[model samples]
Target: MSQTRFRARTRIVFSLLALSVMAAPAAAQTIVSTYTPLDLENCRHTAGKAEEDSGVWRCAGFGGIPVHVTANDMRMYVSYGGNAKNEPAARETLASFHGEGTSIEWRSERAANGKLKPFATILRFRTSVADGDKTVPGQVLVVTRLAPGPVCRVGYVDGRANPDANALARKIADERARNFRCGTDKAVVEGATGPGFSPPAE
Candidate 1:
């Protein structure tokens, strides 16, 4: 074959290879989840009085990240980044009676380098619902954002109303938690909500 023809064919083959490399889809990010038990009984009391007690507890999180759990007035608040002071202001639901569960679910994104960066948390809360002459028990899954600022509740799924509350909460955390803007983005509430289950004002 002529040298001119061979060189021209080689350039065309290289161009095609470059185009295929550029057109290939990027790898999808993997999501990982880990759970830690919250033992308030073992936590160190920080402040408050009697029934209005407050305290902070440290729990293990994904990738050796420190998880801080703060309890105040029967409500639970959480923060990440190893600093309890990074905890956002209390933004509880309008419920009159509510308390958090003993476990926390951390949802993180796994990077190409095998690093797990937490982006959201799923915590269970038991609330009361007034039904006629008696009060009934109700459960809610609170999805909290972990980064881009102080941790804050980003979404909620009423367990009594949604049978797949856990899946829904995880979905919300994966989709909305990363970019949730504290005090600006209003938390989303799904399924049947009681009079006291209203989301706090942004």
Candidate 2:
């Protein structure tokens, strides 16, 4: 009964996930990208010698598109397995990300409420296609709410920035929530292709 109830509520929440992607600025970005869903259920990516977790997910490596994107995963194994002991430790370890540009960038921003929640810790890595430029531009933000497993809920903003920087950030955040697919459906950005390319997912 509890499992059923959990499934029901989760379904309701994610129903908004797909719609959010479409309800964005009329003149905003046109995603010209293609992707394949990475199934983390295989367990091969999660296994290791120690309790620590490590894995990687490649989205565009299959040559479906010129844009290649990959994410390398990381987790810390607690020598002591208790919440209280780890809360402070997590806080200390998840410090402010003080870098920017190239592949990855970290920033400090005041979130909702006067208090801060470490804003965003962006990590990005990708292998570009032969037709693609190595200096491709993209941005990402992820919140890995570690339950029994690392069930990560990620948000990202792609493409280059325009003159208005603040507008760019807000547009990215809006697109992030819109592009979010909470359950099994992998979130996709349609029309992210180069030249006359268009994603079938769109």
Candidate 3:
């Protein structure tokens, strides 16, 4: 190859490399962080406080939200429920909480762990209590395994200074449900919903 041509090609390569380097920070920023059982435990008010009951793992306060995880037969079954249409069943699986708020809608219905099984839904909304009271104005995240119905609902009972944790709860549920590979003897969905769940689509 001609020296001039080689030099031109080298310049193009250098430009591409520079672009990639420049783009690195943006890509890193977009990267979501995942959580583990330990991390969830750490979210408690006192930290390292978690309890297991009937195959469900309950955390006092995950990112300021009362969180619970269940990987039972029901959960594993629903996690793999067919397509978006199964979302209704997934919704039903959740035991009703205090009261429904005005904003109720779908958050996401997708494969857990980026696979075809273990589908889950991460829902966001507020409670029906009056807005002025101290106990009012909290958010609820109902993450249900639509395929098999392992619902991990989180409630942010009190307000917090850092609102980012409110969003992180959903991501935690997403990763937990995606990794929901439960079995008879062993039922547990494991993974961190790195960073936080994406804001609901406008």
Clash count, predicted structure 2: 8
Q: What is the lDDT of residue 196 in candidate 3?
A: 26
Q: Which of 1 and 3 is ahead in TM-score?
A: 1
Q: What is the lDDT of residue 57 in candidate 1?
A: 64
- lDDT per residue for candidate 2 within 1-202, as digits (tens), equals 6999999988988888866766755324332222233333421232334443232222221122111121222322111112312331132111111111232222223334433222222332121222255333233222212222222223322332223332343334334433344354343332232322111111
Would you estimate the TM-scores of all the predictions?
Answer: 0.72, 0.27, 0.36
Tens digits of per-residue lDDT, candidate 1, 34-92, equal: 88776666655455556666656666665666666666666566666555455663434
- lDDT (Cα, tens digit) per residue for candidate 3, span 2-118: 999999999999999999999998655432323323232333232222342124333432122233333332221111222322333222332212322222222344243542222
Clashing pairs in 1: none
Cα RMSD to the true fold for all candidates? 5.6, 19.9, 15.3
Most lDDT-accurate candidate: 1
Please estimate how well model 3 matches the true structure, expressed as its whole-model Cα lDDT.
0.35
Best TM-score goes to which candidate? Answer: 1
* Model 3 weakest 10-residue run by lDDT: 193-202
